[model samples]
Target chain A: MSEHIRIVLVNTTHPGNIGGVARAMKNMGLSDLCLVSPKLFPHPDADARASGATDVLESAQVVASIDEALADCELVFGTSARERHIPWPLVDPRELAAIAAPLKGKAKVAIMFGREDRGLTNEELQRCHHHVHIPAVESFSSLNIAAAVQVISYELRMAELADQAGEKPQWGTQWDIELAEQRELELMFEHLERTLVKIDFLDPDNPRQLMPRLRRLLQRAVPDKVEVNVLRGILKAVERKMESAEKNGNDHV
Target chain B: MSEHIRIVLVNTTHPGNIGGVARAMKNMGLSDLCLVSPKLFPHPDADARASGATDVLESAQVVASIDEALADCELVFGTSARERHIPWPLVDPRELAAIAAPLKGKAKVAIMFGREDRGLTNEELQRCHHHVHIPAVESFSSLNIAAAVQVISYELRMAELADQAGEKPQWGTQWDIELAEQRELELMFEHLERTLVKIDFLDPDNPRQLMPRLRRLLQRAVPDKVEVNVLRGILKAVERKMESAEKNGNDHV
Candidate 1:
């Protein structure tokens, strides 16, 4: 997972920010750093900002463009502070990590951060598969570029840790535990509706609202197979008891 | 909860950061913005930086001192990127939110951020009940004040939403089923200690370290009344069994 996360800084202006990015990545146990046309490299300020993580700087790959940096990457996420007019799959840092986790071995994952001043232009953002917004305060949303990198790296690190711990990764289809398969649940619902109609519990002509409410109740309960069986059994028992009583009355009469 | 947050900015240099701070607070559904002796205010640069959060800036309160800003706040948390010499009661942003949630009606909760150049002094930090450090990349730990505010505010907003939805908070003294009252637990611990000495399981002369460890284990367990009573009963039974055994042995001898 660590090998898969390639952090791409696109057109970073300050050497210090680049250094800081390296430091941030190292803190979260991410090492792969790619720089796209940084204004300055190996600057003393960057070294100062990097603290003890100069090794990350020493080993960082400086490239000419985002395309060059992420050429071989299968999944690329662009970090943007502003909402672009163009429609792209938008995700938060957390969601981005979830998307990256399963694609670990299959794809080379690259997180592209834009320039500090204007951020990723729409054209640059369009190059990536998804746009990741850090969910900043609406009033003052300008996050330092390095800070953004740190945040994204943190999410990636957490996701990697969760993967290592064998904990189910959140925010993916994998974690969505429905009561039953959709088709099965739908069939069960239909059966319940028909039973309700037969038992005169539901007004068949105007059962719109009642059926939806019942569905909601069942969904909230998230009945397992046994629970569903128990409910069906109860309904059957009631129906049988009523039928028996009716038959006995008819015979007596 | 939104109404309860007193967003205190201490010795802020950049008016743009101040504006961004206001914007961040507003984004998180927090409206209270207090500035302590900022270098610039009402600057166009701030207005420009504020983006759409000018409402927050317009309504922001400017104060002379951090103390004056946080004077009414019952719970004060100073946000620090740098680790201090003396460790304060440190909390993650999530934990800070937990503490802040209950204090909504009790007292105002202030989150303080210091100057961009030089962070809050030790004296200022000491005034805070707790310190919140955003987990960042260790190499480049520097986070812009506005970004820091955004993260903190996001946590607060999420916590408030969870609270409204009746979700349990993540920290504080939870109501444990096995937990006895402090006095009762202390008494029980003393009795257990005495019993241990009687049985020669604990040495009377050097029981300090062992007793503390036992106490810590019990504390961690947070035993309830039933569990405490059950433990006492077991201890009593053991003592009775020991006495009977000693008496039987004496008779046999």
Candidate 2:
């Protein structure tokens, strides 16, 4: 259970927070730590703040992109503090632990903590299986990044200690159905957007939120591999129809 | 149940933690806050950290000591991260909320959090009827003060939301024996102090906190109107006995 959990920090600016997060992870008896394009690491501030938990800092894997950080993780969760214009499939920390707990022996679980101020970019967020929110005072919900790690780490420890893998809600992500990987999903999304543009249904210049909304809806739906292929097939058909229409119009000209 | 719960932080040194606590408190819809001897209140750090929870901080009752913080509270629970030598009746966060849930409307409940480094003092620990521990990783269990508040507040909110108080562990107050006003309680405290002085049992000049200790004891009991009247009657009798003894001493002199 300990080794299966991957705690990822994305684009973290503060070296102290990286150290703080390492300390938090070690406290919870978790070892695997990953960083994606962090601005400062291997710095004295991180070493100083890590205090006695320098081992975690030394072994942390620093990656160039989120995809690389989360490539092998079967179940990925991102911590989201603020609600977007469109909602994603969100769970509180406790529920997330319950969901992740069951995947202990079966899957590698990665929990992502975003940057201090801007949080995870929309592209990074859509890569996650679930968006976990630590409930806070709504009006003033400015939770520190490392502190967020602490709370989630605490929950993960509790769930692991409780060994509640069997009771997690059935999210339909069972053994029979394979989930579409982020790369494939991103390709499908690009195809869908292009098809929408070619059909004149979506304005590229004034594309307010057509793609992100679709992404959100599809992300929540968490389409399986088969479903992703079905969606891609539908988009290809629409693209061909537009191509044929354009050719007939050219003939008219 | 929400109205009955008061979140108290004692001797908090960091304004950011205070703001964080305020935000956490607001997230759980538990607004009643009492700060005992905070080092740096009205600081911008707290306001900045509080995000939008300034109202919770603004309406927060800033008190001089834990006694005044719990002055009107009928049930008090202090959070302790580690085990103490003297075992107080302890409950995890959820159980504490369950115990406090039933006391709603009948008694005001206060949950105390100590300073970051040295949790609640033994003397402060003694003031509470029960001790609450938020289960955490023991190796690195130094949870930031606000996060601890967030976890407990979350539990309190869940218990309240389960809405068990309305049906379970009935406190029998059901609109009977109106609680004495805080003003009346203060007046009673004054009278009791004056009478104790007249009896030569207490020295006003060298007061060793006899009145405050008594106030702490009585506040936790949260006596209702009838009980208050009975205590007042007893105090009046003691006052009369002191007067008669003084008169006899005068005659003998």
Per-candidate TM equals 0.52, 0.64
Q: Which regions of candidate 2 deviate over 4 angstroms?
A: A13-20, A42-54, A81-86, A164-253, B1-3, B13-16, B38-48, B51-64, B101-104, B160-253
lDDT of each: 0.69, 0.74
Best by TM-score: 2
lDDT of candidate 2 over A151-248, digit per residue (tens): 77777777877774445433533544555666667788888777666545567999875565556545555455666665575455444544454455
User: How does residue B95 of candidate 2 score in lDDT?
Assistant: 88
TM-score of chain B of 1: 0.65
Per-model root-mean-square deviation over C-alphas: 19.4, 30.5
What TM-score against the true chain A does chain A of each candidate get?
Answer: 0.64, 0.82
Q: How well does candidate 1 score on lDDT at residue A139? A: 52
State fnat for each of the candidate structures: 0.09, 0.15
- Candidate 1 docks with a DockQ of 0.05
